[model samples]
Structures are given as structure tokens and as C-alpha cells.
Target: MDEMLSVRQLMKTYGKGCPACLDLTGPDHGRNMCPVCGTIVACADVSLDVYPGEVLGIVGESGSGKSTLVKTLYFDEEPTAGEFYLRSYEDGVPNLYDLSSRKKRWVRNHQMGMVYQNPHLGLRLDHSAGGNIAEKLLMAGNYHVGSIRERAVQLLEKTDIPITRMDDLPRYFSGGMQQRVQISKAMANNPPLLLLDEVTTGLDVSVQANVLDLIREIQRELGVSMIVVSHDFSVIRMLTNRTIVMKNGRIVEQGLTDQIMEDPQHAYTQLLINSLL
Candidate 1:
């Protein structure tokens, strides 16, 4: 499979005691949670590949660095030291963690997008649903604002959000609806990679099923490679071909979704699978 994003020997740290901190100036020392002292070293020396047209599910308990790993992959957090590559077009490649602020803005505008755990954290709560979706594109300089409302409406409809509510504030929407709005915002630029962090975290099982189905359908339509961070094995099985099991901030086992589910090698993996039974 072709690689869309690759992380090799990547390391990140925070705090004053890390080896990385010795080698380089630490992050603002006043802040205890710096990305330079091995704060998330559970991901140290980690390497993985996300392929085109595939969904890679990352499952782990909270505080295991699953969020941090996803963020770093998308350049949301800079690695203390390592080599990585994001396959962009003819330009050959781009180091996601090393782009200049100006260049990084370009990638953030179009090729990369994230669906956060908290919809409010990623959306403009003050804006209407359509405006929230269109705002991201406008920031990306997507000039067709004339048609953006139309585009936003299509997304609202596709995500099962009623077209009648396009002009409503996010605060007025239910949790599930707000999540759908986040999905629509993420797809605004038709990004190649989407980082879905517990996208269905707060929804009911009934609504989770619907939202997951919607995500799968959209990924198929867009040919987007998704890295979904969720602890739900059923969601992983339903949405991803491959599985990565994280524990204490590191990948303990990874393989085909079914294989890992049916015949896990690691004890922790077995525990996870058993919980489902």
C-alpha cells in the first residue's frame, strides 16, 4: 500500500528532565507541559504508516497519548526530534512537523483537517452551522463564497442534519448534530487525511451507529485516509481495516482488525477484546 503519512523514530518530550530538553532549549519553562521533556515519550521511537484509501483505527484508554500521537501526525504538535513525511503531490513530500508557519498554514487550509473530541473546540460556536463550515474554507481562501452556502447545505443534508437548520447556531443543536457539523467542517476542503478523535464520544449508541455509518460513506466517496482515535472496538471493526492498540502511550499490538480481535497476541489486547464479550 502507498503511504500517505509516515513517522520514523519520532520522539517528543516535555519537562526539564528529558534528554531532548538537554539537547535543545526547552519549551516555555513556565509551562510544565512542554513538548520537549519527554512529556509523551510513550510515543518515543514510534513509527507507523497510514495508507491511501484506508482507515487505521487507534484504540487506547484515555491519557495514553492517543490524542497526542494524532496531533503530532498532523503537525498539531512538533516532535522533539525525528524524521517524518506527508505525501503531497509532485512536491515529493513535506515534513509535517517541520513546516514553516506560513507553509503550514497552506496545508492546514486544504490538505489536512481534524475532527476534535469537543465540537465546540473546533467550531465557531457563535456562527450558524453553514457559516462555521464556510468559515474554514474562507480562511483557506476558497473564494467561491457565493456557492459555499450551497456546499454547506449539501454537507448538512449528507450528514443527516436537516437542511432547515443550516442557519441555526451550534448551541441550539443537539450534541449529535453538532458532531455532524464538525464532520462537515472537516470535509470542507475535501482533505486527503482526516484525523477523527473520538468523533462519536458523546453520542448514544443509536446515534453512534448513524454517525459511524455516515463517516464510512463519506470516506468512501472522498477516498480519504482516516486515522480514527477511539476506544470502541465495535467502531474500529466497523470502520477500519487495520487496528493499532495503544497502552501507556505506545502501540502494543497492531494488525488486521479481525485478526487482532479474534486472536490477540498481547495480554492487554486480549483484555480489550474480552471486554467486548
Candidate 2:
């Protein structure tokens, strides 16, 4: 299958006058008040492709640039080098990182979607489930109130979140249930790709299984390619067929999940696996 998204030679850094930044020739004063010095890349020199209907899992210790990679791929921050691309009807694979602000917003809202670890972060705490879902559809230009209500209900139903809970705020739901609503919202319009940053984090371990199962069900139903970043080996083992292990802002190992789990070549990866054991 053709590449749905591509990232090449990607680099990012925080702080100033750090030795790591010397290689990238970073600014003496870092931009955005980031703590990284010199050019310590949060995520760097990264190249990866997400194919249609595949779920690629990224795993690493905290600050390994797993989520940062997801953010860059989603075009959240300007990369110091390399580029990001998105396929569009008129543009014939336009560069995402280079897009104008207005164009980028349009792409983010209509064509792309994201799911986060915490549902409260992903959802509007003040709004009910109906409102949370509707706001997303509304942002995507879905107007009709009746249509929004109906779609919201349908999505909740599909995600196995009960209809009775529609009017309830996100705070009332359990972590697993909240995650279900979030999945519903992320899959609301059926985007071609999803950027999931630790989708099951913060939830109870028992609940994580259910949420992962829900995500798998929705993926099968929508057939959208996904880039899921997580630290939990169980998440990678249960949800993804392929896994990419990142360490210190670089990809240390990537391949079939089972093989990497059983026979890790990278010492860091082996250490991570052992830690989980």
C-alpha cells in the first residue's frame, strides 16, 4: 500500500547551548522556552510510514519522544529539519509541516482526528457525552442538531457506551468507559488516520484491556490507519501487530511485535521488556 504519512530526518530540541544541539546546529537560545539544551531532540532523524489499515505502536520510556513523534507527524510543531505530508484530493500529497495555518486547521479538523490517554483531556468536562461528540462533529462542519444527536448516539452505541449515559458528564464514567467515549469521538467522522497518544494510560489495568478491545473493534470497523504511542508492553502486545521501540529520541528497534517481545536485539529494548516482567 502507498504511504499515508511520511516523516523524514525529523529533529526537535528544547533549551540552549547543549552539546546535543551542536550536531543540528541549533540556535544558542532555544525557541518556545523548551528545556532542551544545545539540540537535544525530543524526537529526531525519524522516518516512518503508516500504511492503510495498519496500527503501528510506538513504545519507549517517558521522554523517549514517543508522543513527540506523534505530535510532529500530526503537524503540531515545526520540525527543525525534514517534512511531513498529508494526501488530499486537490493537493496530491501536500506537505503537512509546510502548510499554512489556515490549511493546517482544516486538515486537522475535517480529515484527521486524535485520541489521548485521558478522556477528560480529550473531552470537554463541562459538556455531556452528547455535547462532547457533537462539538467534534460540529467542528467538522456537521450542523444539524438532530443529525448530531443521532450520530452521537450511534457512536456511543458502537463504542458500547450506553445511551443512558449520554447526558452525563465525563467525570461520572469509569476510566474504561471514559476511554470508550473518547474512542467514539475520535472515530466520530471515521478519519483515515488516528494519532493516539497513550490511549489507555491512567486507566486501571483491568479497564485497559476493555479499552484496547474497544479500540481494536473500532479499528476493524473503520479501517483507519493508526499511530499509537504507549509505554505498556501489554498495550503493544495486545493491540498492535508491529511495534517500534524508541530510545533517547531514536528508533532502536522496530518489527513484528511478537518477535521484538521474544527476541529483542537492542539492550534498551531488552531492559524495557525485563522491567515489565
Candidate 3:
């Protein structure tokens, strides 16, 4: 099966970097900051492939760079070095990081969707729920107001947001409802790939379950590939087919979610699993 998304040697740094940055920082070194250059490597030499209809989970503790990996994939942050390819975009031929800004925007709107950890980042709280969905459609070049509204309503329904509240601002809804609206907006374009970053964090446990159920339902129904980032292993186990364990700024282990859960090879991965037990 062709990969829905492919990334290689993806790296993100937060300061003027030196050659020593990659060598001196990572799980092996127990840190991600370079003492010689004062650079912080958020992620380095990260690579992965997401197959069509697959849900890939990235799990790590705070500052483990799991979130950074997804953020860079979504173009929320610029990677210092990387090659990104999407099968839907030019048959995954060209490196996306080298694309022009306009082309990148087009890819973002037409090929990929992102649901941020913070609702505020993904939704305009003041805009009506439907309006947020329409904004996404608009970016994807859908201009028919009637069709946009229809699509928005359909997505809201799919995400379990009431059609009656379509005209209501997300701010007026509960935290879970706000996330539902964000999901609706993210899926508005029906992109081939979706990036979700700590989506269930900061929500009530029951609410998180509901949201996770919704996400699983969407994936089952739509067959859209997804990369889900979280520090919660239970969430990873619940939603992902494959899992990647990250530490400092590098991947420590990756395998089938069940296999990794049963037999984690890396010490960091074992430590993570033990914490859940």
C-alpha cells in the first residue's frame, strides 16, 4: 500500500544550531539542548510513514518532541531539515518542505487537515460553528455559500454537534463541544491526512472517551489517515494501529501498538509503559 504521508530526517531547532547539536542531544544524551551552541532541538532525525487509512500514534513525555513532529508536519512550525511527501500531492514525488509558500498552503488546505491541542488555535471562538467549517471550505476554494453550509451541517452532524447549534459560536459550547466543532472544521475539506496533537488532553475523562470514540468512528467511516500525538499511552492504545515512542528529540522505539505494549524494546519505552501499569 502506498504511504499517505512520508517524512524523513525531519528536524526542528529553536536556535542557531551547530554540528554538535544532533550529536550532543537526544535520549542517549538525556537532553535536547546543545550546550555548545545554545540550540534546542525540538525534534531531530525523525522519520515515519503513515499508510492509507492508518492511525499512527506518537507517545512521549513533555518535551519529548512528539508534538513537534506533528506540528512540523502540519506546517505549524518550520523544520530546520526534512523531506515530507504526501501521496495525494504530486504522487509523493517532490519534497514538501521545498515547496513554495503558496503551494504549501494549497497542500495544507486540500490534502491535509490539522486539529490543534488548543481549540482556540483551530477555531475562531466568536464565529458560529458552521462559519468555522465554512472558513475551511473557503480556503479549499469552495465558494458556493449554499454548498458550504450544507457541507458544514453534514460535518457537524458527523461529529455529533447539533445542527441547531450550527449557528452558535463555539465559545458558547462546552469544552467537548468546542473540540467537536474543531474536528468538524478540520474535516471540512475531507483531506486525505489529518494531524491531531494532544486532542483529548485537558478534557474530562468521560468527555475524552466520547471524543476518542468520535475520532475512531470518523477514521473507520472515512478511511482517512491520521497521526495522533499524545503523552497518554492509553489513548495511543485505544486509537492507534502502530505506535512511535519518542524521547528527547528522537524515536526510541516503534512497532505495532499491541506488540510494543507487550514488549517494549527501548528502556524509555519500557519506562513509559510501566508508568501506565
Using TM-score as the measure, which candidate wins? 3
Top-lDDT candidate index: 3
TM-score of 3: 0.98
Minimal lDDT window, size 10, model 2: 25-34
Candidate 1 contains a number of clashing pairs equal to 7
- TM-score of every model versus the real structure: 0.89, 0.89, 0.98
Question: After aligning candidate 3 to the native by TM-score, how far in Å is the CA of 135 from where it should be?
Answer: 0.2
Q: Which pairs of residues clash in candidate 1, taking residues 3 or more apart in a chain or in different chains?
A: 13-35, 13-36, 13-37, 13-38, 14-37, 14-38, 14-39
Tell me each candidate's RMSD, in Å, in order: 4.9, 4.0, 0.9
Q: Give the lowest summed-lDDT range of ten residues in model 3.
A: 1-10
| Cand. 1 Cα-lDDT | 0.79
lDDT accuracy of residue 63 in candidate 1? 56
* Alpha-carbon local distance difference test for all models: 0.79, 0.78, 0.93
* Alpha carbon lDDT at 12, candidate 2: 72
Which has the better lDDT: candidate 2, or candidate 3?
3
User: What does candidate 1's lDDT look like per residue over 1-277, in tens digits?
Assistant: 2688777877666544554543332112322233454443435556788898889999977755678788776677877777677676334375656667877778777777889889887898889999999988897787796788788988888888898888989988888888899999988888888999998988898888888999999988888999999887888989998988876555778999999988999887888888889
